[model samples]
Target: MLKPRMIEEKMLILLRQGKISKWFSGIGQEAISVGVTKAMQEDEYILPMHRNLGVFTSRNIPLYRLFSQWQGKASGFTKGRDRSFHFGTQEYKIVGMISHLGPQLGVADGIALAHKLKNEKKLSAVFTGEGGTSEGDFHEALNIAAVWDLPVLFCIENNGYGLSTPTIEQYRCKDLADRGPGYGIESHIIDGNNIIEVFEKISELAQSIRNEPRPILIEFKTFRMRGHEEASGTKYVPEELMEEWGDKDPIINFENYLLQEGILNEEKIKGFRKSIKKEIDENLHKAFSENIIESDTSQEIADVYETYDHQEIISKSNKENIRFVDAISQALKQSLERHYDLVFMGQDIADYGGVFKITEGFMGEFGKDRVRNTPICESAVVGTAMGLSIKGMKAMVEMQFSDFVSSGFNPIVNYLAKVKYRWDQKADVVIRMPCGGGVGAGPFHSQTNEAWFTKVPGLKVIYPAFPYDAKGLLNTAFNDPNPVLFFEHKALYRSVRQDVPVDYYTLPFGKSSRIKEGEQISIITYGAGVHWALDTLEEMNFAGADLLDLRSLQPLDLEGICASVNKTGKAIILTEDSLAGSFASEIAALISEHCFESLDAPVLRVGSLETPIPFAQTLEREYLPKERFKNKLQELIEY
Candidate 1:
């Protein structure tokens, strides 16, 4: 192995020579990245940190493209939206690069989970700085990865500090790798500067993880060679630090040993550097020639995602129809049949057909290749699904329970939802959040978070009330070239049954479904709430009370709300989501402005109380729709 001292010096030459600009040099810590990357299979992925340029050589990412990215060029993946060091590629299986603390772990979990579910014989190698292990997402990803037995190699390059903060100030542990066992993950510690040791241990660790679904936390004890980046000054080091760390330079030490063993001669070492320098110069020239991604590489190659022929799945009956969940299942079936690249996944979605059995018989019909089951790892499932979507595979992923979505929020909100704006990359991903609260699953299982994601732009959130709407909305979701968070209410999964149209159809999104039109109160709700309000209104002949089922949440049909309220002189917003900052609150505020003159009273908002849900049925029933509240609705109608 060439000493990291040589590699680090050569990298500095590349940077100063402008072969690559703004390099993150692992001056004192080259062994870990280089050793582990070299030990791993050439085809396997290893998403390293900025300092892991040595690993890039092992992974075969052209130095020119890497430099192009750092310089903020379209020729590289930064695509202008990403910082040079914070991006990854699909073709290369680098998965993703996020400069944010611990974001790469989630992507690693995603890639690993996808391989496990799809039965792909591959692994996802994810690296992080030791300091990042303290981040919340790191812990979350590790826990889920361990539980699901994901083939994830989490390399924590313990380079002493996170920018200015020392590791001791952040972590109380002697070795961060020890934290892995609590999550049932296998872990180890290595002298980061020792190439042979790092290479051997990492090779064994990766093979172990790939053979069995488990996470390996390898802590590499090393030091940064320079400041975090070129702009940051490295003058802060103590005087003794230079001599002490310099004596242990892995690159220099390794080169001496290799020469002593005749594995490398001085002439061979010089020739290697000469060849590498030439390669770096050539890569830079190639990167400089290609146009940056600002003008739409995705658009130019847009025809690839155009596998579907756009067959409209229109509903014949808007008056009477099927349960929303059934419609969703039928539409999913149609999408699978129509789109050859489409795939479906969820916990128990295959053998058990999901907890609600919405996907019953799907595994048998589509086979394991298209329909599959996954371990209970939402982030991994969602992350993997987004990756496949990015690769032009249409994915319909489901959360066994909507409440579990928070487990996967980072990828859904930060990555899948914004990948397009970030890289101008289209994520044809549909995440089905099974929500609504009627079930007695308690706080852990009964929460509604569609409103949470509805606030985020770039995500299409839909909450269909009827079966027909579910089918149509799902079809529409599949067609949309953006990320869609499709809400499948567990409460409404089998609550209603109606004969849906045999013909495939999808309802137009961003539109409200007027279940009933009246001159009285404009009752606005969606999902299960749409049924609750309609059932209540029909029992007593509030014949003039119009019921509006808002199918979509993100691109909310506020215009419909204003128009209905303006005529009725009253607006009532309902949701199973908590009252404060809930969907109802937004509707109330929207009505307050858009239909202010039309209000009979401050827009009445009905929803669960601002407390964690109770498992007991009686307490839950009394918790939200208190007797006084139900009576108040009746009193308002009588008035």
Candidate 2:
């Protein structure tokens, strides 16, 4: 606790000196971090809030790393890409908190799930503020934690304010812990200022969770003695409240308690304080002397962003007729049968199979523990899956409809995609989203949202058109070290059937499949668009057009695209996404940039109108009509 205080003081000095950008002070709330963390075992994981510097200090994280992190030095956990406590080290049992406070709660649930699956007597502890309790992720995480019976300790530092908002405005209940009963979990309110009491209560909670394996929510009633951060002034807090909490400061009270117990005299206390200050000061100087990361857009774009390597391996030797959805189910069955660490989670996936009935009979075969029916919470599920990955478990998360991804977009985009690059941690999580349109599921249930994920740097977006490709790609995704967003078109789930290999096989991520070879013009498409182009090509009379299916969206087969474009000398890009800022536009732009001189005609892009998919069948067909694509293809071929 004293070390955290000294580090806070040093950080404030650096903040004023313009050496560091900001600092989140745990001034009056040191007891909560110190006490709760002290109860946790070394193997247990911790997800600390921005203000919980004491938690890191208690966990034995070196002061120099903290100082270097805040100073944006290359030696920092995030390599200076992130600041403050927005960093993590896999070596330490700590997962650093980002500005988004609530999601970590869901992630902690995943870490607990991993420990439970591994039959390890360890737990995952996470911290959040009272204000963060209002976030949807908090509710989702708590609900799932209870449903899954995960060993997790949730600490809510009710510090009276979230930035400028106070507790009164945040919740109607007298205590945030009061809401835990609704989620079927044990909740308790503890004195935030009393270090010994906090430690004892947390120790009991940790033991109970480890023994019984259930989540416990504890509200540590404390106050923020300083502003939210260095940039945010404390003028919004009432003077009386500030002084009142100031008088009950944990560090000051703990010192008095130690002195009264003959733990230390005034001289010894002074010496200890001086020694801690010297350590912090020396580390601060050392961190300042460390190398700073210089921004290199080209290197970042060319080197660090790409995570895939091509491999040509076949899983199956013989072929058997199977539906696209069944192929996916087969791949999942293989994955679960092969790896005990793998868990399948989604809504109505167990017993009820799934809305699409893709996971039918999985529960009976794999058992309930392996095939889980999760609550209707996308964000929390994804976050928890990431947590499972962190604990050396592979998590397979299913988003019922790709359209619902918007609900959990933050964790998928911010946390899942950036985990590998930020901390060099393997986010071995696969999000299976049933995407695309044509089943009359309307805008809410049917959407081609692949473009949204393709724009993200670290995510691998897989959209397979054929059953063979679906099984192969999904199998590959299960073993891949990085995060993968596997998009299975709902329209093609049961509609498409083919003779797929029974044996295990894997396909390269960034490779393209040429369905037909031709001259004159080239058609680049994927998913439903692949069939749309092939079917339209059969009916239309064009000079001669080759159809290329880009299986992977992110690490695009630029080589295949350019080769086909160079031969044909003309191109037509097709997609089911909205024409305005679609992934198809990216393909078109690539051709215009790379194959500019080779082009004999302008590249033609065919996409749906910038309107939501309608429930009416005729309107839907008109929206993404095959005729429009044929018209564009014929025009490009003729030119």
Candidate 3:
């Protein structure tokens, strides 16, 4: 507690000196953060908010690194990308929270779920401000934690005000803990200024959770004496209220309690304060002296893809005919059987086998512990998978349908896609999205939405058309150290079957497979379009057209597309998404930029109609008809 206070005091001087930019002081409420953290086991995870510097110090984060991170030095936790307390270390089992506070609570549920699945007697604790309780993720996280009986502790630091908004303006409840019972979790309120009371209550609650594996919400009724940040003046806080809270300062009260109990004398107190000051000074100097390095590599590549050691996949003895849907099940089964760290999470996945029956029989094969069902909360499902990934565990999350991903869009694009580049952390998560049209599922369920994810950096987008590619690419995605968006075409699930390799095999991303070779026109596409392009070519019996299938969108196979275009001197790009700013447009632009001189005619692009997919089969086919794309291909060949 003294360490954080002392560091904050010294760092505030740095901020004034222009050596640091932002600083959050946990001045008046250090006891709650320190108390809850000090009581936790070392292996247990504690994701601290920016104000919870006491928790960071309690977890033994080095003062030099913390100061360096504050200074935005190259040697800092995030290599200077993150500011203030927005950093975490896997070695210390600390996950950092972003400026947006409530999402980490859902992620903490994931960490706790991992512990439960592994049968580890450990818990995950997450800190948030009173204002954070109003966010939807806070409610979603708590509800899932209750439903799953996860060992998680949500410590709400109710400091009476959220920056400038008072508690009365924030929520109607007298206490934030009162809302926990509504979610079926026990709630408690305690005098956060008293260190002993805070520690004892948290220790008892943590122990009970470890035994029974359930969530508990604890609201530490404390106060933040300082403004939200150093620059944010506390002019809005009435002086009377400030003085009242100042007298109840946690450090001063704890110090007095220790002295009156004869636990510490004046000499020891002076020595402790002096020692911390000296340490802070030395570390502060080290932080400012370090250099800062910045790079635009992620922007240049549009993303960062992980390269791993080549592990030989075990293959089955004989090949067998398998549907694309069955191949996905087999791939998941293979991954779980091979890697103990791998876990599967989705809605109705464990017992009901998901809406598509893709994960059918997984519960019986792997048990309820590994093949688990999640609530309808998409953000929690995706966010928790990130938590599991941070712990060096492989997690495969099913989105149920691609369209529903709009709910979890923030964590998916913001955190999961940026984790590897932002902090050099490998977020090895695969989100299996059932996508594409022609299923008569309408706009809510039958949308092909790969374009939205392809634009996000630090994310790998893989869409396979065949059962062979589905099984192989999925296994490959599992081994990559980057987050992968694995898109499965709903139409192709049962429509296509080939002699699949009944063994462990993996396929590389950014590699295009040639469906056929031709001389006049080259056609490129993916997902459902790949099969459609093949059928159209067979129907036309045109030996003058070439077909290429791009398996991944992020690390796009530009070389293959350019080579085919150069050979044929004409090209056509196909996709299931609408033509306006579609992935096909990006491909067409690439061809025009690279193979412009080789082209004999203008590059043509074809895609679905610019509108939501309709439920009627006739409208759906017209939306992304095979004849429409074939007509464009024939026009390109004629040109």
Evaluated with lDDT, which candidate comes out highest? Answer: 2
Model 3 clash pairs? 316-503
TM-score (all chains, Cα) for each model: 0.75, 0.97, 0.96
Give a tens-digit lDDT track for model 2, residues 332-386: 8888887788999999999999998888999999889888999999999999998
Of the candidates numbered 1 and 3, which has the greater lDDT value? Answer: 3
- Candidates in order have lDDT scores of 0.74, 0.87, 0.86
The top-ranked prediction according to TM-score is: 2
Q: In lDDT terms, how accurate is model 1?
A: 0.74
Candidate 3 Cα errors over 4 Å, as ranges? 294-305, 310-316
- For model 1, what is the alpha-carbon lDDT of residue 208? 73
Across residues 305-416, which tens digit of lDDT does each residue of candidate 1 receive?
A: 2233445656564444666666777788888898877878778888888877678998898887678777676766676676566445678788877788887787778877
Candidate 3 local lDDT, residue 194: 89
What does candidate 3's lDDT look like per residue over 329-355, in tens digits?
A: 888998898889988988899989999
lDDT-based ranking = 2, 3, 1
Error of 2 at 497 (Å): 2.1
Runs in model 2 lying further than 4 Å from the true structure:
295-311, 541-543
